[model samples]
Target: MVQYPFCALLMLSLLIFLATIPNAFFTQACLTTGYLRADAYQTRCPGVEAIVFAGVEQAVADDPRMAASLLRLHFHDCFVNGCDASVLLDDTLTFEGEKTAAPNLNSLRGFEVIDAIKSELEFACPETVSCADILAIAARDSVVLSGGPTWQVLMGRRDSLFANKGLANKNIPAPNSDVATLVSKFQNVGLSQKDMVALSGGHTIGKARCSTFSTRLKGSSSSDSPGLDKDFLASLQQLCSEFDNNNMTLAELDFVTPATFDNQYYTNLLSGEGLLASDQALVAEDGIATRNLVETYAEDPQAFFEDFKTSMVKMGSLKPLTGKSGQIRHNCRIMN
Candidate 1:
């Protein structure tokens, strides 16, 4: 009877040990593929997104020439999936909206930085890291360089092999899109109108090209222009005039949250101080959807983070390659 008890105890111990292996393995795998590491801070909060922003920010700080490519990586990663690193490619396949070059200078600058960062990292880490991961790293670098907060990011996303230029144009919300049109665009991507309003908060930091916001500055369409606040309209008109002669002063979309990733963007909308008509459109019409989302995001940054995360996941999934069609890119600029 004592022998039997000993055997039973050994068997139970073995079972417990076996069960813990997977968890241990999971933690180990996550150590490399997960967690954000930058400066003195190391965490996994914002996951891949934070790494990408920080990486690019750092790259730019090291070499201003890398800013454009890093910015491109940032935009692509954010649009496809909340910075999941799907835009990176291995030998397998590519994701949708993966074009050879950015359609415009703004995009071109961003993509160039991405290319430079990829090259620099490949020299340091070799094949151990993927382009997608580089994107996360670069994003962090970019933000920090621009004097923005460094967010936490998770990792472990696979790379894509293909690029879809057509889809890129179709999906990315244009600066001129009206509120309803913006709502539909977000809806098609599994986001709600409220989500659209919330994501627009990103405009807080980025500068809009003269062409993107020129319509607002021109007061082109009276129907839309009338909706803008009178004093704001005059300011926009003057700014547009200046931009017409000088492309450099293309005007900021959100003067308040221009750099910080906070709720001040929504507060601007509530006060009739929004920079873009599309932004103001959120509050100009309709029921509580706009106000509710703005208030929610304004009051609870965590809620905004949650919704933003969900929306980013949906955005990333816009048109991914599964079951093999594209290849993981060795070079994000050119196909492998």
Candidate 2:
């Protein structure tokens, strides 16, 4: 009896000791095959996250819109070619890139901001940082600056040698996508429907071009779009009519608080004020689960933030070129 109790006490003490170890160490050990580690640069390039965060901070301070642009950049890059920074490449003769894709061309911005961040990192740590990782970190910093939840963005992603313009056009979720299409697009990228709704909360801080949502305006189509608020549609019609270029005219996705990253986006959808057809579909369409998620997020800001952070991490980790599979680009716009 004495020996049995002594052995049990020893085992309990050993278990407590093991539990004290940093969870990341065991996590990295198991996930090292094709995944990244949060502290990947801690040894190789210390202060990397700080450098990227400071760069993003100054940029966002100068232009608050840059935060949304950077966040969207990471999403687009991850969706197309597995967060490989292929979206950052510039087109050249005999070389086509995602920059001109239907989902990107004239729509995506903030490349200059990324270029500036890359330059600082190269100066401080040389080629130790990959452009793909920069996009990931910059995205996290953007969310934090926009008053959203922040998660540890896993690093160690490498830039792809080739761009996927075709995938970029086909893979990205469209503004007019219904709840079903949105669910399908996200699922294609290894994310669940819960992630789709949470990630859509990103629209809280971005603006949509008139061309992206103009068709939903009242009388602009044969039937007034279902679930679209009448007053919101009239206002959008007036705002869009003022511009000679549909692409030039922009509308805030979250009508109440456009620049902040918060649950107001879900609230907007609940009130039939979502600027995009896809956004409203979350609440109005036949997606009962998505509608429940929208209601939950609208009722709880913390839940929305938590889900958004989780989804962002999962999205950033999708199909990344880890280990020796890809090369780190000296210039984000071109291969080293």
Best by lDDT: 2
| Candidate 2: 10-residue stretch with minimal lDDT | 24-33
The C-alpha stretches of model 2 lying farther than 4 A from their native spots are: 1-33, 218-223
lDDT of candidate 1 over 1-336, digit per residue (tens): 445688899999999987878544544355434332222112222233443455555655666545434544555555643444444432234444444324432443455555665565455444334455556556445544644344444334435544445555666666656777778877766777766875676555555555555666555444456456667667767776664455456566666556455567677777776776677777766635776888777787667756755554344334333223243356775555
RMSD of each: 6.1, 4.8
Candidate 2 differs from the real structure by a C-alpha RMSD in angstroms, to one decimal, of: 4.8
Candidate 1 Cα outliers beyond 4 Å, as residue runs = 2-55, 59-108, 140-152, 220-224, 243-249, 298-328
* Model 2: per-residue Cα lDDT over 16-94, one tens digit each: 9999988556654533456588878775688899999999999999999999999999999999868999999998665
What C-alpha root-mean-square deviation, in Å, does candidate 1 show against the real structure? 6.1
Candidates' lDDT values, in order? 0.55, 0.89
Q: Model 1, 26: alpha-carbon shift in Å?
A: 4.4
